[model samples]
Target: MDSDEDTFDNDNVDSGNVSSGDDDFAMEVDISSSRERQTEPEEYHYEVLTTDQIVQDMVDSISDVNGVVNLPRTITRILLNHFKWDKEKLMEKYFDGNEDKFFQDAHVVNPFNKPNTISVPKVTKSTTDEICEICFSRNPSGMMTGLECGHRFCKQCWGEYLTTKIMEEGVGQSISCAAHGCDILVDDVTVTKLVPDAKVRVKYQHLITNSFVECNRLLRWCPSADCTYAIKVSYVDARPVVCKCGHTFCFDCGENWHDPVQCRLLKKWLKKCDDDSETSNWIAANTKECPKCNVTIEKDGGCNHMVCKNQNCKHDFCWVCLGSWEPHGSSWYNCNRYDEDEARAARDAQEKLRSSLSRYLHYYNRYMNHMQSLKFENKLYASVKHKMEEMQQHNMSWIEVQFLKKAVDILCQCRQTLMCTYVFAYYLKKNNQSMIFEDNQKDLETATEKLSEYLERDITSENLADIKQKVQDKYRYCEKRRKVLLDHVHEGYEKDWWDYTE
Candidate 1:
């Protein structure tokens, strides 16, 4: 992945006009412009929506269905929930499927074919013999409520039932009526009327919003901590979605937008790194087994001569060749005889384990180095922002100081790209094309490190111009290298030039 360069452009656009604030509308504008300038349009399109916007979208969807079906809003919402908020599917099924069965399946009463259920009378004193199903008390008509299914309960009982479902159970859109064995869903209006406590009602609303986002295939909550925004995409794919909080994630897997390595491979790499079983593999890689008794041994001393301490089998051997120590005679340090089958077999086995460990560490260390480097990116941003302010004090415009921030952005991009490349390289099987990819990785890594160095170097009045030139030059080169690396990787993906090992 390209580290989502376009997603960060909005933060620096027209530097003079930009200010730190809560609004992200400017970001949406910048994204639109960025997409227009691209030679190849992005595979996915998305919108960052707030809570109110999501609610409005739900209302709009309900209105759209109501325009065609002409059902009550409450019943329409139940039908939509049944279809997972898919209007077209709900419409198709409503028109094509048997009407009575459709309403029954959705746990709703058909508004078109209304059944003669007990009518809820107007608010008044308890004059008629109306017994509440829940409390079994003959309460006033005004003190009782229920869904269209007519399983009425006292107001107190309804409030408790809704509170348990919303606050305790976390059930929102699919909360059914309180009547025993009745699966008919309670609609939002009834919930709002019955649940009088503002806190519980608020929680119920949040739960409904969460359900809408989760159930809809086109929507995803931004994965950043404490961010309340959700992304609505035109379609699902492994493309980046930048939330208003500036967290860019992949729409498909909800991970940080990782290019070069696909989602499945990244998942496998994370699992491998997290697995504790690799500790034993490390021991096998670093230590050797006693040739005679099959006990593990570690060489901590300068001498190569070894002896197994298994009391029953006090076997003596040379650590270098795992052969009988007696054969060395006086040439102890220079034992070159490997004609023994046991020694050759032991040597081969040890080397195989060591080679596997060495290969994994090579890629793992580089991957981790880049990841660790990314941790400093936030501190780097703070440093660059201070530098920008200092440059403005030196008779430079805000526009002139903007390059410092831009450099930091590109540097972060390069670091993220380099981090994901190791995950790509680890599973890659060696071939001519793999060698080319390694070359690209090397070029990007070298440029990224130099860029990082320049950013950290001290800036002063005497070296201001020189520092600006160097920082600009380094970041541009780093950007070019990153693009070239990603382009090659993407091309390889299309051409099937790369192969992976287990």
Candidate 2:
């Protein structure tokens, strides 16, 4: 009889394609026929074994040859011998497996490893009482089928298990298959196949993709063992991550370019970039340079007169104020302070007011003297007094009052020339003590009352003129007082009693 190795090799032969030229063709055919006699139907094989025939054959061969002596049987015997036989006790023992075998391949190894072959633990339909790994609940909905590890669990339990594992531990990381003693990672492809619902499959795929994406895209936590948090990419260029342990790095220094803590020394260095012009230029070249001192000045406004901040060479004219370290060379002018045209215009206006007021005062005094000389008659005197009272009520100045008195006197002179006899007779009758005197006195009294009422109650054009002149005089006086105070202060007499009183 052929040995098992030859039978296995013959079983693997491709029957459809035959190499006719080979001299060993007859032997190959005979071996193939014998292997075919030993083989069972494909359906029966599949039903009795795992999807992979090689794994099924290996398991069958190991079980047949070792009986109670192989690694699997030894693990089962060890579990039974070490613990009291109960469902929970058996599960706990089975789940832990043999420590030596479990930890033989364990270490902080790289995640990228070749596919591992796992020995399926001996689990029975009766031993399927383990709670769902996710919810830790005993109520499972359907029969459990594991990916490759013969670790069977309820379908609902397995799904929840995968979801929790993916969400918490993340993909590509190894997790024990839900079946006890079956230490196999539920990798991306296995997760996709086991999770049958369309939505769940998609979610698992997304999670797996996101895991790789996050490894590349997310900011890395500072590798400094004590640092806890990660920094984002946006804060990389200017403000770098600083650690409490005094380690500082630029935004792009680390693999993730993320630092949570800011460095005190790095912050100081960044601040120097703001203060030192050369340092600022090194960081960002577009900063404006002051023409006067050649130091960098940050441009805040639109004007071209760049002021240097260097104290020794702070020489730049403000185009707006025309004030700078050096004079404007007589070309630039500030009308408010030293413009000749405005100064001349202001002087001419002041001189005109002074000359006009002087002439007005002279004319006003002459008219007043003339009025005083003719104003002895009671009726005429009453008229002049009434006009004066009206001017005083309107807050008119003495000069303005004199002007009004002159205007009234001119009117009176015109009336006297037009009707001199009527005026003289009226005046004489008012003075005489006869029968006609009472009538003339009554007429004079009536005329005096009407004129007094007009003067006291009404605002005539002459009254308005006097009011305007008084206002102008008050304004001029106030201006003069202000100028005197300013002059006194400028001359170092600010603390004098007169200066305080003024």
Candidate 3:
């Protein structure tokens, strides 16, 4: 299960013509060519498979293969693992009727002539009993089974070996033959038959089920703490694929769904945020250097006249320009404005330093603004929620005030989305399309503010019903507006609609 094959390569699917429909939201691209669009709600649009469902799907896939070619399920699992669990490709490659290569490649001894059995190498044995390789017993008690690799061990020893591999060693489905240096996979046949412990067998099957999800590059375990769901999406569109678990994430980066900004920029932005670059940069910018020893010196509010603290280098220099302060003698604040040309690299480094800091600040400020606003809006929501409970004492149900809760939730989501958009926009190469996106972002921000205000209002006010209704309307408006902005950017990315400066 090589991951390189799972990388989202943009396939040459036909980019259908964009159709313009009844557009009212900010910067709407008309998908008119969609031709009689059906109202497919977002909730029902995708599939979410639990562990059981995923395992059942694999079973069904194997069953489909078995129907055409009567291979044992043990052989089938091997083939599936070999083909990275892609059944269609496996069938296409295997089912050309020249099947010896398939069996050989999968290392299944072809029993084509004697159809019902695996063809292991013939071994001379006494009519009495055989010696087990693992336990080195003379078949004293139980049954003995031989693998295709012709390694035979007593059933008890085999169970312990498989159990150790599955449970203690955590080998998953790839437990190998007991023969030393042999990589031949001990199939599920041997595992289930020889592994007599129900617990160990269950663990083996559980690990195999999880392996199919983990080893295959196309699937991901849901990041939710208690979630056991997996999502399947087109490999070509490796953007935000939402799970039914309500956890939307970038299939590309495995982080929470970051639209507009590509995974690379998101990684860079996050690393920049996490590090001390900003703090260190501020320090570096403010601190003066002792030119002799090149040591940093912070100003504690004095005249620009300064001396190097190092005893060896009693170099007197202007704190501002790092030039000799001999001309000014005692007090010289004007030295702070000293301007002189330096090396080319230093000048370029200074320019780049400023540019990087400014760029980061631009994105960070907007990100923080919407985030702070969302925090305040959430507080307001909690307050109003308390009011709803208080009103419940006056005979109002939680259902009756759920609209307030929903409005606040939508507001928060929209603002957070709007916050992330600024980071995306900051990296966006300025073009007509991005400019249009910015306009949409601005409009969404405006609508989100209005929604936040409505959600934050007092229940003590007159026309509570009207206020709630307005809040609902604003919620709908903000959500739709946010979707449009994101959807447009997503489309732009998918269709190569914009350029990036970075």
Better of 2 and 3 by TM-score: 3
Error of 2 at 6 (Å): 36
Indicate the residue-level lDDT of 158 in model 1: 89
Q: Report the candidate with higher TM-score, 1 versus 2.
A: 1
Note the Cα lDDT for every prediction shown: 0.77, 0.38, 0.66
Worst 10 residues of 3 by lDDT: 1-10
Candidate with the larger lDDT of 2 and 3: 3
* Model 3 bad stretches (over 4 Å): 1-45, 95-144, 215-220, 232-244, 249-254, 262-344, 365-386, 389-402, 432-436, 446-450, 461-473, 487-497
On the 0 to 100 scale, the lDDT of residue 140 in model 2 is: 29
Give all TM-scores, in the order shown: 0.76, 0.20, 0.69
Candidate 3: clashing pairs of residues: 19-30, 19-31, 19-32, 19-33, 20-30, 20-31, 20-32
Full candidate order by lDDT, most accurate first: 1, 3, 2
TM-score of model 1 vs. true structure: 0.76
Model 1, 16-96: lDDT tens per residue? 112233354333333342343222335456788867687778778888998999877777877888898899999999999
> The CA-based lDDT of model 1 is what?
0.77
